[model samples]
Target: MAYQVIIIEDDPMVAAIDRQYVETDSRFQVAHVLKSGGEALGVLENCRPDLIILDFYTPSMDGMEFVDRLHAMGQYPAIIMVTSANDREIVHGLLSRGVLDYLVKPFAFARFRQAMDKFLQTQNLLSCSQESSLLDQQAIDRLIRRQERPEPGGNQMSKGLNAATLERVRSFLSASRGQALTSEEIAEQVHLSRITIRRYVNYMVETGELASSIDYHTGGRPSIRYSYTGQTAEP
Candidate 1:
């Protein structure tokens, strides 16, 4: 089950690097490398790769516009936005447009591998369904599409935390190391609801894994803030 990949980037040099990465993985094949949205539209209808690596900045039409056009043509290749834009708005924009996930630019090889592996995990679950294999929906859903599962050797599951929640919490904590982030800030960073984040934070604090403090510096009354203690074992 080799998945074909298409790279659409304006930068030829960067596109070549992405091609190299795709080729290194046995499960993925670089199907095409195109520059602009127009060029992509030219052959995409014919190429129909399993996944598309899109760049945000491109000449002519941009990635989002091209994705819109692609969907209009009844095409839905799993999209992963690979760009230098680390802005939360950009990440939310892609998610709002139904992108599978996104990867920020200047990523290390390990991070790149993580992104690709997560896509493959989702593909694995879908392939099983296509094969007519009977699967428990909850179990499969829990196991499927885990884009950030921690290394199992850590054994942090004993605290009753699964990979999804653990990864979400970890990323939030990592991004909030220097400053205390409000519940809303944590939610936005983790792409979870503020209520849901509170629940997770409460759990971690109850387990003595996270630290929370009262903040009055931002005005509008004082509010509680949550952050990881940086002492919890990475699981």
Candidate 2:
């Protein structure tokens, strides 16, 4: 079943965009697109959504106040803030309140996908923990050290490579384990260009995150295919 999502944005265009981005991933479906935080809060009273795409500046209640109200009501859903607000105080407040991810306006689709991927990963981990009733040290560590964007000079990522895009590719390939995929196949699913996906796959191959093989059965030039190696890449 796909996870249910609710979007709270005042602008119709932005709300539509958020819905489009959220639904792009097969794991999530937008359950509602509310224009005000107050309306959203009322809706949350009965149903608990898996995630929420929220804007900081909305009628009825601002994002911060909305978060506070949700906490007061003992309702905690994964939240990804998609707003134009770049104030450090607002960001810090939202982060302190445990907002899963924040994206300033004019962000790329890659960044949006990265946030969704993060929420899905966290949900998966939580589900595992619930089933096991216990978490190992590594599992605990992974839960605590949620993936974040690398610093500008961070050597963890190669130059000219985006951490978010790399994660998207890695997550998709991981899901398709046991099946080798060409760059074009991956690009089509991830909504990225074939050339861009090829670059990322090459980097993953070099870093040992993916195994590459040649497929000569295409009746023409042999094409390269990549499969996840079941190895976790350094964050």
Candidate 3:
């Protein structure tokens, strides 16, 4: 069965992009696209989706308030924030409130796909029997924990790099958070050669998974630093 999704974004273009990105995965479908949190609340009177692609700033009531009301009414579905807001407090608060994932604006298709893939994995585990074995419980626990820590490996593979190793490099940078890392630094952590790491880094930079910056010094050649941007590459 396809996962039902509701999108609450004020911008029509962004909403359309969100819908398009999710539709690329056959496992998901958008059931409704409302312009504001208020409209979404009204629509929920008749429909309930498996997930909600929400923006932080919406008309009537913003995304945070909408979530507050949802919790007050005891309605919780997996939520992934697709907004331009980058305040650290807001991100931390949403995570604390059990939001599934957060995607900033101008994100690549892969980032959106990453969140949907996670939701699918969680849904699969949840579809199992409630009285399942201890092993099943352990697996679910691990999956939940994986969300808090970025683990490398995605379905998307670029040339000369497999998904597994690509993710390993990604995971290393993600673990570092906003810290600026170079190809040499990442190579050491992922245990790959600099040349190989550079290729992967270049690919990620192009794909929007990572952001690169140039560092100039007094006496040495300029160095490049890469940071995980929490966004995906273009489709």
Candidate 4:
């Protein structure tokens, strides 16, 4: 089925670009595009979308505040914050709150595609599951806690991570909560090199953090799915 999406952006140009990107493929569609969060609210009541691309800043209501209101009302939508802001804290904060993914502003169409693709893949993984997630304190903590790794030489990295490349990869596996992904897919979401991603996936499999299954009928190596045993990825 085609994924329905909404764009909540203040800039007409940016919103237009986003709409075009969402409708570029038949697998995705833009249900509605609005300039402010309040406009989004009424329109959304009548039309629901699978995902919402939110701008952090708008004239009427900002993205974060809108998200807070949505949560208060027990409404949840897989959201991707599409903002020009470079505030690392805000970026990580929203991500830690169970956002499907985060994208900095002024991004290329290719990057935008990667973000949506990864999110849909994650959604697919979520849909295939039959079990329910508990919302206990521990579960909430795991969902929001910092999971980035530190770079070598003890210096801070471009993105927040606390360990070496492989260690960070291991952390993602243990934290995935049982999601399967390809190396390229993981790399896109994590902001890492594809080669580095493959190395980490391989390491995880060797260490038993991930198990590989073959696509014998399809060809090539079997796709590996990792079951995160530590905490629930859901918040």
TM-score for each model: 0.60, 0.64, 0.61, 0.54
Can you list the residue pairs that collide in candidate 3?
Answer: 108-232, 152-167, 153-167, 207-233
Instruction: Please give, for residues 45-155, the per-residue lDDT of candidate 2 as tens digits.
Output: 998998989999999889999999998999899999999999999999999999999999987555676687688777877777566778788767877787544444348
lDDT of 4 by residue, 1-235 (tens): 8888899998876786677556545567788888998888878677768899998887777677788777775678889888887688777777666776678876654466557666655564455445765355644453344222222334323223334765666666666656766666678777898656654554344334565432223253334334444422111
- Stretches of candidate 2 above 4 Å error? 148-235
Off by over 4 Å in 1: 130-136, 143-151, 154-235
The predicted structure with the larger TM-score, 1 or 3, is: 3
Global Cα lDDT for candidate 4: 0.64
Among these predictions, the greatest TM-score belongs to 2
**Compared with the true structure, what per-residue lDDT tens digits does model 3 show for residues 1-235?**
8889999998876776677566545567789999999998888877778999999988898778889888776789999999998899888878888899999987765566567767877776666566854446577686767553133554445244777888888788888987988778888888898777876776676567887665545255446678898887544
What's the lDDT for all of these models?
0.71, 0.81, 0.77, 0.64
What TM-score would candidate 1 get against the native?
0.60
In candidate 4, the residue pairs with backbone N, CA or C atoms under 3 Å apart (3 or more residues apart, or in different chains) clash, namely 148-161, 148-162, 149-161, 149-162, 149-163, 150-161, 150-162, 150-163, 178-227, 178-228
Q: Candidates sorted by lDDT, descending order?
A: 2, 3, 1, 4
Ranking of models by TM-score? 2, 3, 1, 4
Error at 12, model 4, angstroms: 1.0
Pairs clashing within candidate 1: none
Candidate 1 vs 4: which has more TM-score: 1
